[model samples]
Target: MKQSLLEVKGLRVAFGDKEVVHGIDFQIDQGEKLALVGESGSGKTVTALSLLRLAQNADVTGVANFAGEEGGAARDLLALPESKLRGIRGKEIAMIFQEPMTALNALYPVGDQIAEVLELHQALSARAAHEAAVQLLADTGIPEPARRARAFPHQLSGGQRQRAMIAMALACRPRLLLADEPTTALDVTVRAQILDLLTDLQRRYGMAVLLITHDLNLVRRFADRVAVMENGHLIEHGAVATVFDAPRHPYTRKLIDSRPQRDVAPVTARQAEPVLAAKSLRVIYPVPRPGFAGWFRKGEFVAVRGADFRIAPGETLGVVGESGSGKSTLALAALGLLKHQGELDVAGRRWNAGGASDRALRRVMQVVFQDPFSSLSPRMTVEQIVGEGLTVHAPELDAAARRTRSLDVLGQVGLTEAQFPALLDRYPHEFSGGQRQRLAVARALIVDPKLLVLDEPTSALDVTIQKQVLGLLQRLQRERGLSYLLITHDVEVIRAMAHQVIVMKDGAILESGPVGQVLDAPGHPYTQKLVAAALAD
Candidate 1:
């Protein structure tokens, strides 16, 4: 057996009087990949941060014995002095944090950021570090590394920003790497690429990896060993295949069964009217021309070009694509939020150009955005957030009637005063991600819209919560005959909810057909690649 690289025993983390992480024991073998799996607030992240003493205002205790050099004796990381620990950080053990958009400094160029790490830990000169930074970017499979390194974080794509973060983490060739939800915000193809990069780097560096994530599919494809956490306790630990195939703990079993299940019934043969229809829909933005021609005319960039689709009553038409693919642009055009060149009608009513919004048409169609927390106003209470529509659409209703209507819709979305005391009076931040999403759904349903534009509704939620939300949407569709124009990049979500699917790439629909036809046996090469990427794990 390989020697243990890190052995953690009786690890505890607490903030104030609330103990979030209970004492846990685990170990990592040299060159091995171990995944820590759990939902949000499960204490997996706290455990990882505590090892490096990164958690602020928190009390951490236990023994983290790390073997140093090639054959040197083990040392307790918890008892080390601050100065000594700083030397080991980013040199012997490094971390790749989630959300590279917020993690990377927006002020500095990506190349300069990578060079900073090389200068700090490796003591390389500025000129040497800059060149090495570009090489590191190339090693991570980034295209145009020399040019990309000089670009700011905001100027890069999501995948490119994440690659820059990975390049910085690998600059020092650390012995151990900690990756926290590395691929959560990435598209399916980019997620696969990042996973492959990590595997390759691990083999070249012979570094033991401690991956903290809730994605079971990623663990199945990437990790050798797995540890399951619930609340603050480590409930299960074993080989990935063993724990996944036959989970002993009930919590683990629940997580395994949390994958989205298809419950959508077949469309009836009633020949119902189409809720939404678009023909040759195009959205273009004007950009300033280059230096010589700037004063003459602006350049035109077509965001959504020649898109055509329809959503029938009681049906879901899913738009699947990566970021900047114009899926969101199509959603905005359908909601009458953006100006378009072609025809887009909701409930057979066209949007009035350069005029007041049609009140009746507005009440017939509503939208739910991607992030529920941000979409919902922080200053508004649950009653105000969910019932805001009534003020404009149903102004004749008295205060008592509005309250009753808000409570009714809230109950339909599975939230009630019984489950949450004074539910209508509470704020958005007072609830969990799942609960906030439910509120968003209730707000959309409150207006009794015939069509709902759902933009990445479940992208920001945990697996179990996503499953629940999808199930709720399915139930509402059956009960209320709701039509949905679902936009997202997750293939699993499309398979579980969509009756018909449209594959988008670079502002064009590459393929459109039934979910089984497009996802199971895709005709287009791009569509095939997307399906293959989703199933790669």
Candidate 2:
């Protein structure tokens, strides 16, 4: 067997008085890829962070032995001094965090940030470090590396920012790379590209990878071995294929089987009226003109160009695309939140630019945003959140009636007073991600809307929770006859929730048809590529 690059024995972590990660053991061999898979709150991330002692306010114990370079003496990372640990951090071991936007320094240029790592760890000259940063960016498939190097973290797209983070992590050529849900926030195509880049770089540098993620598809595609974690325990560990093919643990099997399922039966008749309809819709924003032309006229950036689609009552229409593809713009237009140039009708009424009619239209159309944690107010209680829509649509109702309505709606979304005694008084932060998303759904449903615009509704959820939420949505649609305009980058979500589908790219529709036709046998090259990438993962 190959020599172990890093080995952990009886690891444990506790935050304050709560023990989060119990004693667990695993090892990564030289130049190998190991995936730690689990759902949120399963202690996957906590376990990884314990290796580097990065989790704040947490107490860590047990041995994390790392084989030093050139057959030097192996060091117990858990017992290392802070001074020595600092030396080993970026040089001997590096980490790529989950969210690049927050992980990177917003005030500094991304290139300078990478250069700083090289200077600290590799002790290179300023000029040499800067040059190396640019080269590293280019190696990670970033375009216009020199120009991009000078750009701040906010200036780059999500994919570009992630590439910059990767460049910084690899600057010192560490022996082990700790990637924590590295592609979780990325678009599907960008995710595939990042995975390919990591795989290529791992092969070239001959480094071991400890990938922490809940995405089983990613583990199947990228990892050589898999270690399954569930509620702070190591439930299973073996070769990737062996564990995936014959998972001994129920949690592991559940994770592998958690792919979204299509439960909404096809509508046979066309009896219901269209809840939303759009014809040749166009949305444009005025961008600053570059060069001398800025003195005269602003440039027109078309966000949604002549897109046409419709959603009937109780039917679901999915819009799939990458970031900056204008799918969210279309959702905004459909919700009457944005001004558009073509014919867009909701509940047989057109948007009236914040007039009395527009206020009425708001009652007929409600939206559930992508991230429930941010979308839901932290200061607001569950009762306040679910009942706020009633203030606008049913202002005449008394406080007691509003409370009753809120409770009823909450029950409809699978939350009840029986489940939690203080359900209404609880805040968003008090709930888990899945519970928060259900609350978001309840808030949207409380308005008695005919149509719901779901923007990446399940993108932020774990696979199992995603399945549950989709099931809730399906049940709600079937029972309430509500229509949905689902916007997301996940093909599985689209397949599970949508009856009809439209594939978008660069503010234009490349393909539109029944979900079966569009996704299974996509005619457009872009759609084909998307399908292939989803299947590959």
Candidate 3:
């Protein structure tokens, strides 16, 4: 029989007394795509990092045998010396982390970063590295590669940065690639493209891949084998088709059952008026050309064009689109943050285009951005963070009153103010990704807003936590008679919450109707393509 490229026997990883990865075993043949899927704190990332001896401050033990001529005969990855392990990092194994914003260097140009990897792994000169980097960028579908290569990490969009990460990981042509939630934060369109790129690269290079993710949609489409993990245990493992179609373990079955489906409930009477309305909304910017020196000239760019929509009370209107499709642009415009030509109304009140005195509307309309870490202020305590809006609107409340109110609201969002005082007084980095998102939701809820604009609120969360948040949102809408204008690329979230669905592409509305009708018989080809892309597996 042909030898496996990588094998694990009774592998275990622990941090102090807490053992995160239990004794588990798996093997991957050459060119195989194996997915490690589970909820947050399930130890998937820890296990993936172990392959390259990359676990951060953790004690790992087991037999990790990297067979083939490349892995230096017999020394296990856990037993390898630092010098020997350093050589394997880029050349033998590579990883594309989940958050490119945190993983990438903000100060450096993306192209230079990719070039740095090539120079480190291969004997490439400065000039040669530059050319190779440009090719890599172009290969990853970055338009205007040469110009984009010169741009810093902040200049590019989220999808563009993720693609740049892929370029860097593949630049080394490693024997094995570890992709940890590679497309979790990407838009559906960009996610599909990235998945395609990885598959194509796998075929072209014949490199074994360990795709660590919670996205079952990705697993069905791309993975060869699926391993289900729960609380640091491998619950089940089998062929991708079998596992997805007929998951044996209860946890795995629960995961499959939890996947959102198109709403079958009948639409009810629209009793309440729309909380938010937008018509002919257009946001345009005159960007500079490639060779231009200044941010001038008629580049003829439009972020959002003629975006017309409404979110009624007690209903969720989902804006579904890929990255750069102007979904967030529409949200920002509705908040009066961006200058645009449009008619906007929130809770029967006309939006003031003067960008002044949005206090009344702010109280009625609140927003939850994608990244809670960036959205929440680090310096302020949880009381200040959640009560800032309340203080601005109702300044009569003193610090003590505000703290009491903040604690009450935090409890509403499944967080105990007493048990989580560390979170209340601490910074964004102190809380986990899921906890931070819940805090963001709590802040929005503190305003008692009639309408909430949730822009990819659960994109960064793990699957189990995502389900909890979705359930919480549904309950909030029912109890408070609240409305939501949910902007997301996640089809599942839309399925779970959206009463009305609007599909947008290239700043134009592709289709919009009742969720049942739109999802069942999509009228527009673009909408059909989106549904197809989402349900591709």
Candidate 4:
């Protein structure tokens, strides 16, 4: 039998007095891919970080044995001397962090960063290491690697930055890779590409990977074995097929069953005039053409072209597509944020009417942005944030009235002074991600908008929290008879929330039909691919 590459036993992690991870045991065979699956704060991350002795401000104990080094004695990473561990870190075991934009150095070129790893571990000169860096990027299926190598972290796309991160982690040809939610921030197509890249590279290097992620679909596609964690305790571990097919632990079952569920009320008032309507809507942008210094003569890029859609008074019209598929542009056009060359109206009034009328009409349609923490002002209190809309939309209401209205809407979104002490005076940063999203909904709903545009509302959240938020939105829609212009790439989310759905690709609407019909039997090839790429694990 092959020797285990890593054997972790009695692993425990704590932050001060609170122990996040309890004693747990697991092992990975040579070239095996094992996934540590759980939601946020599950201690999977700290477990991996503890192996490398990288967990900060926390006490980590127990044994993490590594046998990656050839002809050398196996080392207990938790007990290894700092100096010796540093030598073995990038050489034998390397890590690919979750967020590449923050994980990578913004000041230096991606190639230089990758080369730095080679210089430290492989003892390669700067020039040779840099050349190797470009090759590694190309191996990861990045186009024009030499050019992309020179670009900074922010300059590259999400997928490219992740690939570059992978290249740097593999620069020293480590025997084990610790990847933490590597594709969480990426689109489905890009996430698939990165998984394929990792699979290929892992086979080539004969490396074992400890993948720490909450995405079960990714685990199904990539991992050979799985370990489930809950509230920092390892509850179950087994072959991927066995565990996923028939989860023994209730927590594992809960995680698997947490896929978005459809509970939305069917549209019975389809004949009613739509809260929002658009026909032949087109949004075009001017860009500088390549070569000949065409800055003087720009090229035209059509972001959304000839789109037609309508959301009934109490129905949802979902726009589904991948990144750069013009879904968001269509959303912007619907919101009256972008100029369009077509017939579009909100509550029977055309956009860009100018002055008080336009501002007042805009209140009929409100938007809940993707990221709530960023969308909400940090300095403002919860009452201030939610009631700010009332100031503009209902100026006649005094401060007391605004506060009353704010509390009412907040209650609709599931926030209450009962749960959160001094809730009104609290700031945005104090709330959890799911709670923050709820606050965003309350802010949009306060003005009593007829149409709510939910833009990837739950994508940033994990499955459990995502389920909660989707439930909240579903309840809100049913109770208030709210019309929604939901823009998202998540097929499950569309199935759960939308009544009517439109599939878009490259600024063109490829298919339009009911959510059940489009999802269950996709006519378009692109739509089929998107649905197929959903959460199968």
Candidate 5:
């Protein structure tokens, strides 16, 4: 029989006078992949962090018995001395955070970061540690591992950086791994690759794993056993297949069924003129060349390669691609934020490079950014933030009129004074993520824009919250006949919200057609690969 690698009993976490995580129990068998799944604020992440005594300002109490790496005597992690726990961390047990950019040191090369782990845990010399770091990166499937080892965190792409993080985490061949939302920030194909790599590494190293995430599709893909949490409570747990097939808890069932579904209207005839149109549109950037050429001239990099598309009134055109694929560049060009070649028109009028005449079209095109918190001003109140657009598009409106329009628009996006007393007075940080996004949408709507550029609008939201926001957008579109240029990497979202879809890769459109046709029967191999990845998830 397989022995339990780690077992927890009566785990409780508190911050000052307020307790967040109630008592909970769970166990991971040796070489097992156990997933702790829940939405934001479910205490899943806190529970895992507290197990390692890494949660700052947190008081953790529990019995976390961890078997030694070589199957020797077990120790209570919760009761271990800080010095002893440090020895265990990154050696007997390690962690991979959700965002590699923040977790990885920006100043040092990723190789040094991995080498640092090896030096601390394995007691290896600097030279030996550095050599081993390159090997580790290679094992994680990074290309040109030796060269990549010298590159800093920001220099590497998202997937490459994440792979480096995994290599560092696994450097000492830990007995157990705690991965907190490891693939949440990754693209679909990259997410699948990471999961597969982790599975292979776990089998090779014979290490048990605790996967913490809000994504159920990932849990289904990666876990053997599943434990669901809700608002700091452990709601249910069982084998992955058993729980998914017959979820006993309401929250568990809801999560399982929360994958975005096609809820918008079908693609209709494009009889009307397109609100936004672009033909053979291209965007380029200049980069300094190394050595001799750099002194005199710079080389050019094409961001968007002759892209052509359109979005009629009440229609949605989704542009899906991986990071650095230039979907964002196309959106920027469409928004008149970039210089582009070829013909591009908004409402049958061209952008005169930010001329006063372009201001007229700006009112017809407003955008909702990906991260609402960062995009929104922290110092600005809801009234100011939402009404700021009005000053540009509707300058005739006074403060009182602007405030009234802001409140009405907010109410339209599902925010109201009844729900949030003095809603206009609150700042961005004062609201939840979903509420903040609602404010962003309300801000755009207050200008009475005919089109919206949604740049991964729900990518930062929780699953249920994503559904709510998408529903709200769909409702508003149906009522207001709004056109949307939706930019995202989520195929499920594209399937749900978009009428027309374009698959982009390396700054070029690989496929373009109705969502049903492209998603259901993709003609391009890359599109097929994307569709397959989404299906696997």
Candidate 6:
């Protein structure tokens, strides 16, 4: 058999006596595709980062051996010097981080950034590097490579940016590629395309890939070998077929079961009164650029065009769409965040799209955003963070009452006051990603808004946490009579929560009906395509 390209043995990582990774071991053979699977805070990402010596402000100890010319070279990757490591980083090893928006340079044009990688590592000239970058873009299946090359990170859609990032990573022709949840932000179709691209590239280049992700389905489809991590421990590792077919670990079994059933039980007509309504909602963003005549030509780019939907009291209305399908635009507009034209009625009270104040609307509706870290303020403590809405809307409550109420809400979201008291004093950085998201949910719920817009609220969480949050949301709705406008691409999540489903494409509604009807017997061809893509195993 061929020698292993990368072998990690007895890998351990610690933070201030808190050991997160406990002597986990794995190997990636030449041209091998390996997956590290686990929930959040599970040493999967740390183990992957350790390969490139990229664990910042953490004590990592591991034996990492890379194949050499004759036999192989075994070295303590953690002890490698900064100078020696620089030569190995991009030239021999490349990484595609989870969040492309955070990983890619937001300020630079996508093509120029790709060109920079080639210029630094490959020693290519300026024009040659640009051409190589374009070719790489084309290779990644990006449409209109020429026009896309000049687009900034923000200008491109989520999937396009991810492809651009992958293009840059492959530009160096590295021996190993570390992909950390590379498809987390993409839709089903885009994910299939990216996975296909990665598999094809790996076959062509014969590069060892260490894929770190929480997506078990993706691991099943792509990985040759699999490793499971939990709370910093490697619980199981084996061939993909063996591990997935008959898992020894209970964690693995739970994950497999968590894979949402493609078909949902039939939906009964919601009996509650309608709590939120949007009539002919339109959100248009103005894009102004100099024309051929050097004059600024303003064009109206319709994001959410004439959207209409209603959410019954204690019901969830799922908005399904691809990236830039205006799902989020509709969510923001519903919350009165964006300048839009629409008739919005919450709890039977008519509200103007532009003139209504957030504080006035707070009593009727609230929003939970996709990213917890960015949505939450890092400066304030959890108490102040959650209570800020209360202080604004219900000014009669004193500081002590607000603190008590905040503690109650936090506890309600599966967090304890004892575990979270420090959170109130410290900033957002002090908490883990899951805990931070729980705090975000607490903030939204403390206000007791009748309507909640869950904008990919569970997108960042692992499956177990997602289920827990979904259950909590159901409970909250049941108790508080809360209505939800749930915007997400997770079809499983839509199946679990949505009473009614709306299929959207190109800023317009393609189909709208009960969730079961849409998922089982989609009328439109586009909806059928989405259903097939989403359910493809």
Task: Find the candidate with the highest lDDT and give its number.
Answer: 1
| Candidate 3 whole-model C-alpha lDDT, 0 to 1 | 0.82
Q: Score each candidate by Cα lDDT.
A: 0.88, 0.88, 0.82, 0.86, 0.88, 0.82
lDDT of 3 by residue, 179-272 (tens): 9988876777677788888888888988889999878878888899999999899999999999988888889988776665333333353666
Model 6 Cα lDDT, one tens digit per residue, 1-537:
967788788888888888989998788899999998888888788787877778887888878877763465655566789887887787788998876777888889999999999999989998999999999989877777987898899887666788888898888988899998888777787788889988888898888889988788899899999988888998989999999999999998987677543322232435555777889988998765556633646777898878888887667899988876888888877876788887877776766533435457766788887778778877788888999999888899999999899888888888885665565676777776677788888899898888889988887777777777788787777777677899988888898888899988889999999888998899999898888988883
Off by over 4 Å in 5: 71-75, 80-84, 100-168, 266-269, 355-360, 377-384, 391-402, 425-432
Give RMSD (Å) of candidate 6 vs. truth.
2.7
RMSD score of candidate 3 (Å): 3.0
Candidate 4: segments with Cα more than 4 A from true spot = 50-56, 73-173, 354-358, 373-384, 391-404, 425-431, 535-537
Where does candidate 6 clash, by residue pair? none
Sort every candidate by TM-score, greatest first.
6, 3, 2, 5, 1, 4
Q: Against the hidden reference, what TM-scores do the models get?
A: 0.86, 0.89, 0.90, 0.84, 0.87, 0.92
Question: For residues 210-295, what per-residue lDDT tens digits would candidate 1 score against the true structure?
Answer: 99987889999999999999988999999999999999999999998899999998878327668888999999978667698989
- Give the least accurate 10-residue stretch of model 6, judged by summed lDDT: 260-269
Candidate 6 Cα outliers beyond 4 Å, as residue runs: 69-76, 134-148, 260-273, 349-358
The number of clashing residue pairs in each candidate reads 0, 0, 0, 0, 0, 0
Tell me the deviation in Å of residue 384 in model 6.
2.3
The per-residue C-alpha lDDT of model 1 at residue 168 equals 91
User: What does the lDDT read for residue 79 in candidate 1?
Assistant: 90
- After superposing candidate 3 on the true structure, give the runs of residues whose Cα lies further than 4 Å from its correct spot: 68-71, 261-273, 290-298, 350-356, 377-384, 417-432
Candidate 2 lDDT over residue span 1-537, tens digit each = 788999999999998888988999999998999999887788988888888888888999999999988889899999999899999898989998866877899999999999999899878999999999999998877767998899898777555777788889988988899998777656788888888888887899888999998788889899999999888999999999999889898888899899899999676534666788899999998766769999999999798999988788788999998766888889988887788899998878887656788999999999998768778999999999999999989999999999999999999988999998989999997777789999999999998999899998886677888889999999999888888999888898898999999999889999999999999899999999999988877
Between candidates 4 and 5, the one scoring higher on TM-score is 5
TM-score of 2: 0.89
TM-score of 3: 0.90
